[model samples]
Target: MLMTERRAVVTGGCKGIGAAIATRLEADGLSVVRADLPAAAGAWRAGGGTAVDVDVSDTRSVDAMIAAAVGLLGGLDVMVNNAGVAEQRARVDAMPDSDWDRVISVNLGGAFRCTRAAFDHLRASGHGAVVSLSSTWGLGGVPGYAAYCASKAGIIGLTRAMAADGGPFNIRVNAVSPGYVANDMGGSLDGLDAEAAARAWAGRDLQASFQPLGRQCDVAEIAAAVSFLVSDQASFVTGTVLPVDGGQSNRLNTGEQQWPAP
Candidate 1:
């Protein structure tokens, strides 16, 4: 039987940006299988969607995840590499080897594993697409995010290289680079109380001086970019990193800029 509907797998899809992406894709009529860690999977209430368990950092786990998704969804058309982690901010001099390895294994290696595992399936779909999550920090640098920045920057490199490889197979690969988003992962606000989190969020707003949009991005906004890249609307697009960073990536944030009155 010909499956007319598209099928997708979203890593780290149980919550935050991944969840938003899964929900958005579902709304677009794709059958989505949300994959998170085994621990987090226990808490997933997929509602009308499907959920699975896999640790992106583990190759065996990632392979099992792809197999499970194929079994449940019948096939895969889109792969959203959104699973990642961030630890306490520390300067490079103080960063531990364990922290760097953990972040790289999950954030960068996970994307590579997932994409590679799904390569054959995507080729068979004849319209396979991949949208990975990068960050504005990936484009440049942050003082205390050595491992994180390296991992995300690696995603951009991986995206472009894989796009080239997938092109011959009719599989499009791209990435979305987002700016400061108020999420449990990116902003170091996971364990803070409401008041403290609010203050932290407020502090990040200083980017408004250089950011055109003048604020942080919502998860849904980032998901929208993922949605477009996966859809036929972007059939011709590949090997590109789309910035969902409110124009933050367009200019260097050297310091406060003085603009003439318009």
Candidate 2:
């Protein structure tokens, strides 16, 4: 299908990585509909994209958002399930049930609701694609992100299952797992004092040593990956988890190892 003839819906499309994906899709010549919280309506309008107020955790809201997207765009060709939330740093034992439930509901459950709502339109398009955001933390465990990790991991599983189900309709489903990108969510040095923040930022060299690429992923880089997965080039690509995490997923931390004079 031609880019100009495509229509896409991106949840959480008002800021951060979501905004980047929406912008990339728009640049690719697709009519983009950005569905975010009502508070983000202004940002979405400022970006000159059609905005829909949506709370992915709410079934009624999700259905309304999908209906609006389809109505506005005439049909849906791509669905980007980018809406998600993270809990404050806490171990599973210490975490509140509300925190866990909220994270799962918005991150994993939201993707499921959005995907299900868009299924018919996607199937009708015959060249439809869905890309859900997963995280590198989802692939492995992080010390204090139990809820967030579980939700993202669930998205990966859901993506695979949806791929199998959507295959008959020629709809592609995939997940993009991004490593730490410098965004509000990833770059947060929250709760740290100025000195601590500075020290942490200065220790980027040490942090980079743990990952093969020696740097954090960028929002645009991740968006580029999404662009490909939703485009004709990746027509044959589905039921796969693409990691854009600078090799963080496969890296092993050896901790301060030095070569003796190579």
Candidate 3:
């Protein structure tokens, strides 16, 4: 099918990576429905796309979002589960139960809700594709991010499971795992004071060295991966977690000395 004829809905499309994905898909000629909190509806409208106020953590909101998207677009071709939350840095023992629940509910549970709500519409389209945002930490592990890691890892598992079931309906499901990307979510350094922030940013440079590419990823780069996965070019791709993490997922931090000199 032609890209221009396609219709898509991107969760958390008000800002950050979600916004980037919405813009990228729109640029590819798809009619996009940007879904985020009710507070963000105006931003979506300003962008000249169909806007649906949705809180993915709530099934009712997800249902309404999908209905609105299908109604407005006439059908659904793509569903991007880009809505997620990050927990404050904490080990499992130190992490609050509330934080864990919130992260899991928004990250993993939200994806499940949106995907389930969009299933019927997607099945009807016969060319449906879903891209869930996972994380490089989900594939591996890192200290001080227990809940966040668990939630993202759950997304990867959910993506594969959905792909297996959705395959019969001619729907393809995939997960895009990204590394550190500059967005509203920022990185672990978020919320630090100027001096501490500077120190953290410098530390990030040391961390980036672990990634063979030696740099942080851009939100648009991640969006481009989503574009390809949902496009016809990836028709045969399904049940896969594609890491857009600049080799971060494949690397092990032996030491700074171990990194090849640029």
Candidate 4:
């Protein structure tokens, strides 16, 4: 089926990568219900897409978001689990339990809630698709950011499990692990000094000078990756965490890519 005729739901579509993905999907002809923080005007700008306020960590909010998407957009053919949070950058020992819980609630818990709520509708789609947002931080090790890394890593496991569960129903579940992008909400970096932020993110020793791509990724690139996965092009793909990060995951000495921010 053409993407325009497909009904899709994209969480966290208010800004950054999520918004980019939503815009691309809409441009491809999909009818998208873009959900994000209440009063997010950017998400609504995705042409014909409808933007709804949704907090994925809450069960009722997620359910309502999905219900509205299905009822208004006609039925869910795609679900993009993009809503997530990053805990304050602190060592595990210094990280407060409250902060850790909050990260889990939004990053891990949010994905679980949204996926669960959309399962039946997606399963009914016959050839539905689910694209989750993950990060290299989820892979491992970032000195000051334990909760964020752990939460993102947990999402990988969750995505795989969902893939297994959705296989019988012909629904595809996959994830995209993106690296540093231009506009990021989770890290609060827009206000930082560019040089300091770059060093903090890339490290003085590793320097990131050798980074094959030589620069941070753009959000639109992430959207293209997601679009390919949702389109018929990736028909055989499922349960895979494809890193849209310009080979950093592969080139970062010993296949290690650290989290962009704490």
Candidate number achieving the greatest TM-score relative to the actual structure: 1
**Considering TM-score, which of the candidate structures 1 and 4 is the better prediction for this target?**
1
Please give the RMSD to the true structure for each candidate, in Å. 2.7, 2.5, 2.1, 4.8
Instruction: Write candidate 4's Cα lDDT for 184-243 as tens digits.
Output: 567576568998788666652253444566567788899998999999989999999999
Model 3: residue 107 alpha-carbon error in angstroms: 0.4
Give the alpha carbon lDDT tens digit for every residue of 1-262 in model 3.
2499999999998788998999899999999989988878777687675788988888898898899889999999999999888887888899999999889999999999999999988999998999999998897778999988999999989999999999999999999999877654634556778899888767766676578788888889999999999999999999999999888878777775544666
> How many collisions per candidate?
0, 0, 0, 2
Local accuracy by lDDT, each model = 0.89, 0.89, 0.88, 0.83
lDDT of 2: 0.89
Off by over 4 Å in 1: 1-4, 46-49, 257-262
In model 3, what are the clashing residue pairs, if there are any?
Answer: none
Identify the leading candidate in terms of lDDT.
2
What TM-score fits each model? 0.93, 0.91, 0.92, 0.87
Better of 2 and 4 by TM-score: 2
- After TM-score superposition, the amount by which residue 148's alpha carbon in candidate 2 deviates from its true location, in angstroms, is 0.6
**lDDT per residue (tens digit) for residues 1-262 in model 1:** 1223999999999889998998889889889999998766667853544788999998999999999999999999999999999756899999999999999999999999999999999999999999999998898888999999999999999999999999999999999999877566643676789999888767777664468777788889998999999999898999999999888988766687647458
TM-score of 3: 0.92
Sort every candidate by lDDT, greatest first.
2, 1, 3, 4
